[model samples]
Target: MGIRVGTRDDAEAIAEVHIASWRVGYAHVLPESVLYADDFEPRRRAIWSEWRFAPTQRVAVSVDDTDRVVGFAAYGPERERARGTTGRGELYAFYFHPDVWGNGAAAGLIDHVGERLRAEGFDEAVLWVLDDNPRARAFYERHGWHPTGIAADFDVHCELSVPEVEYHSPLTVEGRP
Candidate 1:
């Protein structure tokens, strides 16, 4: 088991894992067409291409011995209400293939992103999760994340504006979890 910084070259493997994650972990939540379609690769490629030029962003891709990404976390900058109070960086996405769940992959991903944010001048961090995903919500809570009750229009999967809950952590890496 190994993990390292991701690059543009990793887009293919990352896309496969991302789409697999959506299919297995979010099948009940995300729309069938979006999560199960053949367009996943193209959309993923577009996202990776855009991220390649975004400086200050971080991507920690967990891999097996074969360098296949099983999980990843990508985030940078504080925006919206996140920048209003905490004045810290915000998490754009934190996801892992459900096959790798409970295998220390998530903790490593969080630590990588959190450390990067701390070094990049963010004193706090926040992430949004679906309100009904109890497993993920519990995992965040275990890692010292708490809800800010700042719901948003996270209609990425659903036809309507799905209720998304915000989770925040003010402590730095040095702080207890």
Candidate 2:
């Protein structure tokens, strides 16, 4: 498997991974109606297409040996203001096919994003995970991320409301160019 910078042509595949991963990962936490909606894939595809080309964001995709996209990560400048310190970069999204959940694809994708974020000059990064997702929280923690004790309610598809917490990690700081 290999990781690469995402392009416009990758939007559909990335969206597929997003929906498939969410269907399984958020099965118990999100509304079935939202996850199973007929238009979810297409809508997510459109959003990803635009987001992949955004100036301030970086999107990375992980592909299998056959070159099929199996996972993706999106990170960029922090969108939300931090309460106590200067806002850090954020991992806006990260997902992989359910089939690859335990096969190390997710960890590889996170490592790739971390490298990209640090190269972009960010010293720290943050990501939000559903509070109810112990598996996901543990995964992030194992990757050197820790909670900042922040929590908030996330409304999905304007239908399901779930609680989420933030996790943060410091990126390896290279001497600035």
Q: Which candidate number maximizes lDDT?
A: 2
TM-score of each: 0.86, 0.91
Cα displacement (angstroms), candidate 1, residue 92, comes to 1.0
RMSD (Å) of each candidate, 1 decimal:
2.4, 2.9
* Best prediction by TM-score: 2
- Those runs of model 2 whose alpha carbons end farther than 4 Å from true positions after fitting are 81-87, 173-177
Clashing pairs in 2: none
> How well is each residue in 1-177 modelled by candidate 1, as lDDT tens digits?
676888888877777777777677776776777775676657876877776337767777888778778888777876676236646677777778778888987886777777778877777888888887888899889888999888776766436455688888875657422
Model 1 residue 79 lDDT?
60
**Global lDDT for candidate 2?**
0.83
How well does candidate 1 match the true structure in TM-score terms?
Answer: 0.86
Least well predicted 10-residue stretch by lDDT in candidate 1: 78-87
